[model samples]
Target: MTDKTVLTERNGRIATLRLNRPAAMNALTADMLSLLGDELEAIAGDKGISVVVLTGEGRAFTAGVDLKALRDSGQDLTEGNVGDALNGAARWVQQLIERMPQCVIAKVNGFCFTGGVELMLACDIIIAAEEAKFGDTHAMIGLRPTWGMTQRLGRKVGMQRARELSFTARTITGVEAAAYGLAMEAVPLAQLDSRVDELAQAIAKNSPGSIAAYKDLYRKSENAGLDAGLAYEYETKYEIADVRERMAEILKRLGG
Candidate 1:
């Protein structure tokens, strides 16, 4: 379970996953990605976990993938094994986020760049501290965003903004990211923890099945046009009510 690189804790209705390599600003390692993938799968069907928050152990959220490890391993970043390894790890993380039943949120604080941005993009919601910074450093680092960042970033912040971030490798503050729709909100560092908790709790109180259905719809309709989205909405019209049926039964049992 690569506890050194990643840590997980169940907090009532919320499950918090932490990137634990603080010495290197919690850079994503291959083992960490693998463990995270497995953990997400394990909790996918757990009704106890209504929300999941991905955060860092110390100061920075993540500096991105571990470049030193790849270089030292003599990995061929040009083509072949290196590219495959990097792509595979990134995909694992993305798939984990997509498949998890829990509402995934990114609690960002300081330096989120390159692969870091890719990870945050995977989250359903992102809450950042004022000190947080986001950037697509692939161009500057001589690498490319092959981890669905190109696909998702544009959808989140528009193509023009995406190009500017990826090509120019310019950093954006938390407030700027929020304004650009990259982050849900930017709070003071002191308020970051409480804000994440507040958001998670608000989500946790909702019916799990309803939340899951809505999340699924959001993912499917993100790229859909108005007509297609309308069809999807109509198809899932009774989703919330269907899940609420059991609520009445539970209330009856409680004599509510």
Candidate 2:
């Protein structure tokens, strides 16, 4: 599990997972995908970790799926679901990233295209270097997405923008991605790490119980009507272990 294709590092309450095929532009090989999933799975259950940042070791966040590697393995990329073709690595990893309890951030540093876009879309927050590249090339190869690309992309950006990018197979900078609502923000590459670290630290300071509930509630609200969503939000029962202590601390600070 400690192979170079994927690497995991921990700092206090935060965990960082890096894709490590720099030579191949950190292409998403089967092993890389599976290992990434394993790292996420472990973090999901780790009470110590409140956040995870996903990025690449070298130039790219990831160049996307390694089609050549899949072809060499006797898989038909043009066939049914690409996930199925790759023996479920694509679908599994992305799903794990999205479903995991920890808040996940995709720290897009460089080139991110096709399946790379799919992978990042699974994260709760995406921030990138302004110079980073992003595109959806599924149309270029006449392939449909099976890794939640179509669904998540449309949700991240609007359906119109998603279709435009997918159909054109055109590349856009991280700044453009932010404008398109694909990434929440983009900063100079030099500042990306510090910016992401700041964000992760802020999130880590929050009550884990409340944050987990928020994640679940927001996801569920997506499918419900306004009335139902509001009702769910109020009626939902989520206990914050630190609620009493936090309130007392605030009162003391205010000299109550």
Candidate 3:
């Protein structure tokens, strides 16, 4: 685990990234962040890979940032040191996940706390297992969030619920996460990989050109008002060349 804090695998058009520090419950270290950032950078440039699934190697998705690592590095959550310790490389990894050309899914197999939750939220989609725990324990640890937790959490689960979770520092089951809008769905642990694969395969089979366009359009729309988003959608040039071929293939099954 020291040598490989993150592992990568590719199957056709889908890539899977697994956090490899099971003994530490896949805790986040600066080294792990560097490795993950490198992996994501490579994946982002791959036109053949359209989907990525991120999960843990063992029981916990992650117990959040490696506090021991931070302490050993002579950093702590004292006053303003929290953000300083986590910014640079760590922040880059979060941005990489958000801006990647391909869709990223967080497969929460087990305990997900604080920074782990932040990392999980960075993914475009979240499919959690029913037994997994989702918690924002920053308050309990006396450390403020340096990751996008303050911003992204509210967006995912609405501001009020987000406030409650962060304020209370409580944990929730994956089923509750879906109902609260943090996860797309919560399924049995045994079905998590299969379900993710099912969706990943379905998405991978679609036209890559259109997929790229959709990703670009969706990313752009996130910051724009509705009218502006719609205007862009209507006026911008859509250069996908396989629409006719796709339509023809679909129409062949229409009994027309």
Candidate 4:
């Protein structure tokens, strides 16, 4: 499925969603956010797709919300209606991606700023290209982030580093992002696509039902205390059927 702003391509059990606004650095306008949300919702219902990769068509994963679009809309921020609508749509997209049963990977090939960073945080994993740039420029633009950036950024990196990055609005290289625990890893720019594909295929090879259950359990555990998380995990394990059969198959494959 190809839209003017977003493109979706499926290869077997994996789907790739590309932000198509290369000239605009794949900035998220309100319309683009809505389109992305629709696409993601469709993917969530697709039982055939077990993995989703999100990237950009050009030099940026996304530059974040389109400031120019907001400006041109002549919407008064003080009134809050327009701003709230845009933020609400962006939030819905993030939540949809986060709650989807399929594993979502952010292929950060280039610039990822503000809302883009928030979008990446919502994914299950992020693999960035070495030359990719990341930043939170909300403070620099005289606006506070309406998305989950404030909370997610601090959680991924330490609060101190998050504070410095947001306050200074300084861009970090992909290498620095990995070191700071923002990205899973940074690879050579030339190998970014292949690396993401490899990881996605690895994930796709697993049992979809088990993977979905684990993804949901992990999300639930993140918010629960250790004791509660442990209890929840223990209880959830019984929910998966054919455990013994699957284990036997694994052992047989290993020649046990």
RMSD of 3: 2.0
Q: In angstroms, how far off is 123's CA in candidate 4? A: 0.6
Which pairs clash in the backbone of model 1? none
Query: Which has the better TM-score: candidate 3, or candidate 4?
Result: 4
Candidate 1's residue-wise lDDT over 64-111, tens digit each?
A: 888888788677777423366667977987888975767999999788
lDDT of 3 by residue, 1-256 (tens): 2558899999999999999999999999877888899999999999889999999998999888887887788764576345554666678888898888788989999999998999998888899999999999989988888787888899889999999999999999999999999999999999999999999999899987787677767866876889999988788886777888998989999964
Q: 178 in model 4: Cα distance from truth in Å?
A: 0.7
> How far in Å is the alpha carbon of 42 misplaced in model 1?
1.1
Per-residue lDDT of 92-155 in model 2, one digit per residue for the tens?
8877876777899999999999989988988889999999999998788777777777788888
- Count of steric clashes across candidates, in order: 0, 0, 0, 0
How well does candidate 4 score on lDDT at residue 169? 98
What does candidate 3 score on TM?
A: 0.92
TM-score of each: 0.90, 0.93, 0.92, 0.93
Candidate 3 runs further than 4 Å off: 80-85, 238-241, 251-256
lDDT of each: 0.84, 0.87, 0.88, 0.89
Off by over 4 Å in 4: 1-3, 78-82, 237-245
Between prediction 1 and prediction 2, which has the larger lDDT? 2
Q: Estimate the TM-score for candidate 4.
A: 0.93
